[model samples]
Target: MEKNPAVAFNQPNHLPVCDWLNRAIDQGLNERTAPLARALMRVQEQLTWRYGYERMRPGLARKYAYAELLGSNGPVISENLILSVVLFAPKHIP
Candidate 1:
């Protein structure tokens, strides 16, 4: 089994993050466990919500983003690392 490619939404890529995750699910990338795929779906939603709010109000975005990063929505962890990086993300970044 091949390892899954890292999901990178900020970088210019062929597929948007949501599409990429859906495709992976459709391809049974997480066949070993349906939970994994579902977890990823949740991650996708969290990212979408976080980024969306981020554009409107960074303070508001931080609420959802921080929760998502802390895995308040699911069993996923490690988003804290991503949040850490986001904390220092450039103001000009989109």
Candidate 2:
């Protein structure tokens, strides 16, 4: 398998949760959805950091990395929301 050029293994690809949230808000993200969006971003950052891009395979059918932030166990303290981040391999078809 060839390395994915989009994945930056040596550098951080995602911004910090607070920075992301602020940017989202500045970009016109609905105020009502800010909390949920923040939580989702946090989960995404955690997953990406946990599984570096180098560890992810690049293909259509290969296994992907995922992380689930459920209820009180995650950044969101709500029992109703479940935020999940699934990092799929970038499949470039040429």
Candidate 3:
């Protein structure tokens, strides 16, 4: 990197970001997680609605690029983190 800064998006790497993402998603993630897909779709839809389509599109793309650059493509944690968070919510009684 220090010697070849152009290696970030260079010819040797045919799919730098895509390959990285594919490798990350390849591990442990079951592509058939329907409920999780629906939940993510809802979250994306809400963001699209609130931020407007054009703005959200570019912003989401930017986020993807940012995550790719940072190599933050780990296993999906929505089901684990989100479900756990919701489950532990304070129980109220009248």
Candidate 4:
């Protein structure tokens, strides 16, 4: 079986940040949403770099793990927007 690139490198599996954002905008998002999308991408990049695919503590209340990347207290403050990554178990059924 072929190994996943992100797993082999101990990195998160996500599209290249800037490229993804540009594509999203090109697809349908209005020009005004560009700034917000850029901010969201920055947050996503931060979380991906920080956690990658590390295991979470056992017996946690939530089946997934996540970190707030943007919000009132996050690195990127946003009054009207928030971005986070909810990491599910590998090959999760649901």
Candidate 5:
């Protein structure tokens, strides 16, 4: 049996989510990691760009950390399981 790399999203030695976020924080860090900084920045600006100099209250991001966000690489796909008298079958099992 051969392991398919395409189906292994978020796996170590593969594209890491932290790498993506790191590039986003610093535009000149590395082009390969933060290729979509412009788009991400635009989305953030649209969501929270009105604060300016006016004192604003921080909400969810107050306790947010780079590790927390980067550690959220979701599973490649959802998997289900079924149990029966004969044998259990899992959706992810080939």
Candidate 6:
């Protein structure tokens, strides 16, 4: 198993969730990882207003970190999941 190049998305912290997901999708598409890119696209649709990685089960989190995100080169789609959790998870908690 390999690790994805974890990215940070909180420099300014005002980016919309949809925009963030789109950027990541573009990165994945550019990297030619169509499957993962498509999967992420689905995630975007499935995602709720308060969604974040923290709400995911550990297994799901692992699923998101596919080979494409952790390629030998720097991650094509770079966004910090932790930052997402911090910002969005609270609203999602039930």
Indicate which candidate wins on TM-score: 4
Best-first order by lDDT? 4, 2, 6, 1, 5, 3
Better of 3 and 5 by lDDT: 5
Clashing pairs in 6: 7-80
What is the C-alpha lDDT profile of model 1 across 18-45, one tens digit per residue?
Answer: 3334555555454775775576555554
Cα-based RMSD of candidate 2: 13.5
TM-score of each: 0.29, 0.29, 0.20, 0.32, 0.23, 0.31
Q: Residue 73 in model 4: shift from native, Å?
A: 2.5
| Candidate 5 per-residue lDDT over residues 1-81, each given as its tens digit | 123212322322312222243334465335763644554444332221111224534532222222111112312222332
lDDT by residue for model 4 (3-25), tens: 32111112343432322333553
What is candidate 3's lDDT per residue for 1-94, written digit by digit as tens?
A: 1232221221112211232333333331566755544544343212211111344443243223221111112122122221110111112311
Cα deviation of 34 in candidate 4 (Å)? 19
Tens digit of lDDT per residue, candidate 6, span 18-80?
A: 334565677678786877678756644433333244576653332232122222222333433
Per-model C-alpha lDDT, please?
A: 0.37, 0.41, 0.26, 0.44, 0.28, 0.39
Q: What range of 10 consecutive residues in model 2 has the weakest lDDT sum?
A: 1-10
Which ten contiguous residues of candidate 4 have the minimum total lDDT?
Answer: 1-10
Clashes of each: 0, 0, 0, 0, 0, 1
Model 2: residues with Cα > 4 Å off, grouped in runs: 1-62, 69-72, 92-94
Q: Which residue pairs show backbone clashes in model 5? A: none
Error of 5 at 23 (Å): 8.8
Clashes (candidate 2): 0
